[model samples]
Target: MAFADACNWINGNVNSNLTNRNSIQAICYSDVKSQFGLTANHVVRACARVAANRLTAKRKRRKVREFKPTSFDCDARTFRIIEEGYLVSLSTTEKRIKVPMRVSNYHIGKLQGRPSTSAQVCKHRDGNFYIHIQLKSDAPKLKKSKNVIGVDFGRRDIAVTSTGNSWSGKDISSIRDKYFRTRTSLQKKASQGTRSTRRRAREILKRLSGGEKRYQSWLNHNISSSIIREAIATDSIVAVEDLTGIRERTNQKPRNKTERRRSNSWAFYQLRAFLEYKGIKEGVKVIAIPPSYTSQTCQKCLHIGTRNNKSFKCENCGNNCDADYNGAKMIELWGCSVNQPRGSELLSCDINSRATESLHLPYRKCR
Candidate 1:
């Protein structure tokens, strides 16, 4: 009720008339507090939050929509963490309620004996309540490394590293296929005549989707951790492809239905994000470079190559190599070239130049 009132106030006054939070508060505070039985502080916080959101959306050239039905924001001052991080006291319209939280040691470590700035209380589609807390911490100083490791991300092999190691996507692909098969069966049942059968099928479908998401998240965490560990062991900076606008690009290409579905469902960005934050915590540099021709360009000769399935055959040098491994090497070379003293000269050097020849020496072996 308080959230709806705040959204109403913002839509009616602040967004429409460009009025300030103070003016809006003066106009609606008393009425909102009286009608919703909310404290004065809650009303003020809600107004301020809505106004701030409006300002941010305007700056970003985005349209600000009203709050959804399932979530609400709570100011840090209005909530208290007590009982050794096991309980949270939240303020509501009638009275304060203490909610028990099942927190892990990982979360406790992240808190680091400091209170969170604020929290969002949300109800998931599966009918579960969750609290997301935001905290502030200083990042550790990055460690300097003399080596660079390039990572090639793909659907067949989840990640291929310059160190001649790869994480396979077989398990992830199999799980996705299994989910699709199960959902297809459920859909047939859902189209039956009985209402109860349809309702049951829908519930099962929702649960299956949630389970698939959790499993994928686990796989990504393990893969990212292994990649970071390899970089730390070698004291190397991690280089990856900047896959921005990849979905749009993929959508533009011609593909069959199954291939298109697989392309759209892959979680490349999530894995990248995991690598980035984990890299930061481990004091390793993770950089993203434009993936213009990382796969098509030969890592050994820098010549254009034709890829047949997983094999890459260099047109000029006749060098045969694994396509993903070759891409990883090119990414690594690019990383090294950009970090050198004469970076631009190295970057724009001809494929037959002495500098390019020397750069190929380190990563010439085929995996």
Candidate 2:
């Protein structure tokens, strides 16, 4: 009830520019504590957290109506490890509760003999209670790389690199197709069968819903790790296309049912996210450039080409290359252009210009 009250207060005070913690505390801290019977520390922490959240939402251009109530936010002062590692003493509005916790060895390793800074206690959809503890640690120094590698993400290829390496989506595609068939069969069973059969189909559908996401997450981890390792080997930065709003664009296009489903299901953003955090850890710079005309622009000549399926052919320069490869090259060139010294002449190159003309590689026909 105190949590909900704090959220409501935050919503009411959101438009008044109550962004600072001290400012919000001055306005509502005493009232919240007295009305909700919350402790002084709890009121302070709650007000600070709520104010921070509102400030973040405003910065993101989100309206006050979009703010949802947070479950609970507890600081280190409000919780303590009571029994070495298996029990937590948590403070609540009513009383302090000693909650038994089950933690893995990996979690223990992360603690590394350091104290946790804060924890958020929440209940999941599965009715399991969980606590997320935040720990502070010094980041490892990363080695800087010299070269740059571009990655082009697609449904068929998954990832194609500027270094001519590719991660195929054949296995993932097969897994998706299997799940797709299972879902289709389940839908038919649900629609045409009796009540019991429909219930069984629903159960099966719920069970299978998370499988594809887990499989894709696993694949993305593998792909991102490999890309990072490759970049580290070549001392290279990783360049990638900015695929924001890709789903909306895909939905707006004229696609068949299967194609639309596949496009929507493709985890382009997930792959990019994996690349970014892993790159930071490995000291590889991952840059995202606008993907405009990446596949259509010829890398060899300053000409816009026609892309048919996997092939891209340039009529003006007679340069033909794999479409994804060309896109990767374009991304790499864009990264290079952006990384150059400010006010450099290279920054003025057209999107279709031969940014790699200085490299002087022999043009090869598309296979």
Could you say which candidate leads in TM-score?
1
Q: Per-residue lDDT tens digits of candidate 1, residues 31-71?
A: 77776677777888777767777778788888767766576
Weakest ten-residue segment in model 2 by summed lDDT: 343-352
Runs of candidate 2 with Cα error greater than 4 angstroms are 1-73, 81-87, 92-105, 113-115, 122-129, 136-146, 188-192, 248-253, 280-283, 300-303, 312-321, 342-367
For lDDT, the strongest prediction is 1
Candidate 1 segments whose C-alpha is farther than 4 A from its true place: 1-27, 48-72, 83-87, 92-101, 122-130, 141-144, 188-192, 209-211, 315-318, 344-367
lDDT of 1: 0.82
Clashing residue pairs in candidate 2 (N, C-alpha, C atoms within 3 angstroms): none
